[model samples]
Target: MARAPKTPPIPPDARAVLGRFETRGPVRSRPMFGGHGVWCDDRFVAIVFRGVLYLKVDGETRPLFEAAGCSPFRMSADRPSRLAFYTLPAGVNAGSDDLEPWLDRALDAAST
Candidate 1:
């Protein structure tokens, strides 16, 4: 049998996070597997899970995130799978101006 549809609206916290990207272009979210996928101008750039935002990272940007003490998004503690997304450094709010640089990088990475 097919799984039931997930049509729950984006949580308030997720909306607040995505709001920061609105200036970049059209920002939208879609619920997926208990989290929300964030898109900017139709480009998939980030994910909000458990209220934490993770931005897409490529080889060029992964080092930047790592140097900033960010960790990759793992499926679970028991799983070794790691995605290309990484969280911002501790205390960096998703809506803060500090996200400008990182956000630009993530958008660039997503474009590729």
Candidate 2:
């Protein structure tokens, strides 16, 4: 049997995370497994799932996020899932104080 469809409404906390997304293009958010995927233009730049915001990770940047105690994103709503995105450190909220530089790195990674 097939599973039910998921609604695409953006969550409030997810919206706040994107408020400081620092993008010039149109921003889009869609729900996925109780979290959110944030897109700028056509690029998949960020993810907010399970009440935690995650940034896109690449070869070099992956270590940084890890060093900061961030782990890869995983979802098991219907089944087990994992993605290239890494959870932003627990202390880094939508305010993005120390989160900005990390997000910038993520943006750079996504661009490349």
Candidate 3:
């Protein structure tokens, strides 16, 4: 059997963004499909795939992403598409400012 791919180290900016949620608990890291799944209170909030962060939020957060013009991850050409994950746009990747709200949404979704 093939081993699950290991996730890369958390980026400095991403670590800073996660620090804001320290009250929630230390972020848990797990390997997932050549990426990392970050969790709070044992719930998945975001994923780092190929050095890009993707927030996991449900339908209610769709408008926020739409307004930001963020796009959903297209995992592959032949698989059924998934919509609960949104990619951070190019220019916004390195800062905690653009990521906090989305992180909040993902945490909210994960909590309840």
Write the residue-wise lDDT of candidate 3 on 4-53 in tens digits: 65567878776666666667777787777777778887888877666667
- Residue-level lDDT of model 1, residues 6-99, one tens digit each, is 5466667556766877889998888877777889999989887766678999989999999999988776768754568998887677557687
| Count of clashes in candidate 2 | 0
C-alpha lDDT of all candidate models, in order:
0.80, 0.75, 0.70
**Candidate 3, which ten residues in sequence have the lowest lDDT sum?**
88-97
TM-scores, all models, native as reference: 0.82, 0.75, 0.73
Clashing residue pair totals per candidate (backbone < 3 A): 0, 0, 0
Candidate 2 lDDT tens digits, 1-112:
9987665555676677777774546778776666678887667888877566778888888898999898787776565545678877878877757867876877777887
Over 4 Å off, model 3:
1-6, 77-80, 89-98
TM-score of 3: 0.73
**Candidates 2 and 3, the one with greater lDDT:** 2
Those runs of model 1 whose alpha carbons end farther than 4 Å from true positions after fitting are 1-14
- lDDT (C-alpha) at residue 49 in model 1: 72
Could you tell me how far off, in angstroms, the CA of residue 95 lies in candidate 3 after the best superposition?
4.6
Best by TM-score: 1
Winner on lDDT between 1 and 2 is 1
